[model samples]
Target: MTNGARDENVTLEALCRGDVRTCARLLTRIERGEEAVIPLLQALYRAGGNGRVIGVTGPPGAGKSSLISCLIGAWRRRGLRVAVLAIDPSSPFTGGAVLGDRLRMVEHGCDDGVFIRSMASRGQLGGLARAAGDALTVLEAMPWDVILVETVGVGQNETDIMRHAAVVVLLQTPLGGDEVQAVKAGIIEIGDVYVVNKSDHPAADRTCRQLREMIARGSRLRPDRDWQPPVIKTQAHLGVGVAELVDAIDGCFAHQNADPEAARRYMSDRARHRIGEILRDRLDRRLRSGDEGWLEGSIEPVVSREKDPYTVVAEMLSRL
Candidate 1:
């Protein structure tokens, strides 16, 4: 039905008004890689900007899903409309997610004010799938008060989530001194708020102490900003500390709002990163499906070193 008729049934008005069925169908088209929705996406971009995008990221087994479930209940209690975009592991053949819609059922399944959807990571090394930005774009167009993005468990290599989230919450399982020392680099620096989940564990206090020391010692990704990432403890399954986490998230937003220059600085950086992400994705598709089979045809020359990778990149850039 979405072959060429971008406006066949779905309308921006419906999306902006938070029409569930219409937006779900539009999201389906986006996941299927339908180009017909491009025009609508462009239009949506101009009209959209109402939602607050918060990103939650952590390593596997950190209880990210459980924490998020608790978070949904908290937000709903405040009478806020919330949406979740959970990134799940993909089936190699079908690119279907292993987890997503099922995660939110117990707490928020029947709530009309809550909307949850999942996308497959499609073998991305990062937590997010390739279509994540587009999917997020769709959600931001809606009347959601808060949009939560939960990506697959990630590590040092996963920086994609930081680009999309206005505020980032990094979750940790209780770790020992060495374990905490090990995470002081890439992934840890991007956190706006740090959380030690499974706080009931014996090591939780130690973990929190280690994280605070690290945060105090480390230089942040946004060093010029005054917001110091707080390390809090939580047992998410028991609904412990979730409210504090929410408060921490709110504080981060307030921090941004109070400083227009800082907000603009971070947003400018995010915009640059967003542009690069889209450009890279488009160039990847071009190299994969563009005229006369580019990647396949050039493999032998590049592999044999008759042409170095730099030369090959130069040639490709010229074509682009």
Candidate 2:
């Protein structure tokens, strides 16, 4: 093998052995879309399939970061190593992350068992970075027992990103008008556990009631329900009711593990999503690297109304 290949193998081995620096380097490479990332991710994939991937998603201002902080503590108390991938919204001008979720997780910075990484969504609309699945693969190679993925706080659109997770925790608060309606419409179904965070609010109980009703209605519509997510109230800042939330999360994980078919289905879905993403990225790269002059020529004719866009695109594809 080449020296570089050997060095990469050594790095991967160190990552699997719980080397945090190596893991961070791999994640950075993945985020930067380096060519080496593909092979590195493949190796990590082979070393993965161990960590429980939990997705935490909700609307903005739902205290997701605070809730995650509590969760990290809870998992640490159980002697389980935890890793967090917090997806932050990107600045439109600079394409850098605007809100650094890691800042909220300062307490765990010194904890050797806790690893936190903030990823920029880079304007991807689904509340996740395009490379989130690959990042998860990298984390899987590490010795973390639990991996928490926090989304970009996009309400309904957030559900799409949770498909990679084994357990989906949907956080909501008492600020409940359109937000609750959005959850009722679609997001509720994706959650394995629902948390009403900031439950110290006066409207907390009412919001919980609304969520229970929505879940009940959903359960009725799908008679073959295998798992019913429980709604737990939590004042995350105060760490109130967080233990119960952790219990619910653990129960969800246990339920998925107890059912082989369910676990297999989740894995299969994740694989399908990853494959689709990779194919899209590859096609995009190929298109961008194609004859730029030809592409501009094709677009000019269409823009000037000399040709229809559909015909131009068809002709371009035929040439390809």
Candidate 3:
């Protein structure tokens, strides 16, 4: 079938029943700024609160993927339909990653109960909050019980991941100096659960203790009666601590039940992010259509210090 016809069928199925492929196609259409997806996304928002989204994030090479694989296995054993959204880093040259997750998640490919979508970062720095929110709408509407969002490990972006996940698992290791800096970027402060991945390493105990100290400090700062974020050490490659991690996540879900405010914030953020995505797309389309020379013309002025980015944006908005 023609791509247009296929997408139309996709839209129909996605709206009527939980169709993963159709949802994927609609996501692509939305990503490409096709106007057809606007109503579909709106419908998804109207049918919100379908699934619990768990975000797994950490520094690069923290065994996050392995941990997620273990978690998926554990969740699947419970007969839960799982959807995994693994966001891989894009190469600066080819705009793709060397390590694509599709190769690793082979078990899901054949299982109708499992859905896996691998996303390229696409040069979106802090916009993961938007991509994940869109992905969740697509997955939640489908026949999935749990949605997992795996992020390309970075600092500020980690905080952005929490905005999308109902339970945010912050993974780290036993490194001393720069490691602390990476965690202090604020991911550590927001984790619903702390995971010291590669726990077989010699410094696992040290890392666990450091994370506990940090959590204690955070508790003092917040003074909330909520359960303290538990730090679990895990040898993900060997599947050790996977069960405990799952239990910890369950605890997060339980805690969230008691504190409805967390769910309120999740919904509130999702709504705000949806609005931001629409506005951003609108602005981008306007800028692209306005003038190819607009940016070229601004360069000389910027080099001469005659105008700053703020001034340029104001001028552009004024023209719009």
Q: Tell me the tens digit of each residue's lDDT in model 2 across 23-125.
A: 7877788778787667767777887877888899988889889889989999899899999999988888988667668888888989999999888988777
TM-score of each: 0.91, 0.93, 0.88
lDDT of 1 by residue, 1-320 (tens): 66445464348878988999988898888877777788888888777777889999988778888898888899999999999998888887786656743464477889999998877788887789888888888888899999999978886668789889999999988863465564557787778999999999998988888888777776554568788899989998899999899999999999999999988987898889878977887787676564556656777888888877887778877886
Measured with C-alpha atoms, the lDDT of residue 262 in candidate 3 is: 65
The true-versus-predicted C-alpha distance at residue 145 of model 3, in Å, is: 0.9
Tens-place lDDT digits, model 3, residues 1-320: 78866665567566447677676776677556566666666666666567788988887778877888888899989999888888877766887566466666665568877778777777777525235666677677666789888888766444777667778898888773444653464566778899988888888888888888878777877664467999998988788999999999999899888888766876687668667766886788788785778778998888899888889888888888
Error at 20, model 1, angstroms: 1.4
Q: Identify the runs in model 1 with alpha carbons over 4 angstroms from their true place.
A: 1-10, 91-97, 176-183, 219-223, 290-294
Give me the candidate number with maximum TM-score. 2
Q: Candidate 3 — worst ten consecutive residues by lDDT sum? A: 176-185
- Clashes per candidate, residues 3 or more apart or on different chains: 0, 0, 0
Instruction: Determine which window of 10 residues in candidate 2 has minimal summed lDDT.
Output: 176-185
- Collision pairs in model 3: none
Clashing residue pairs for model 1: none
Deviation from native of the Cα of residue 172 in model 1, angstroms: 0.1
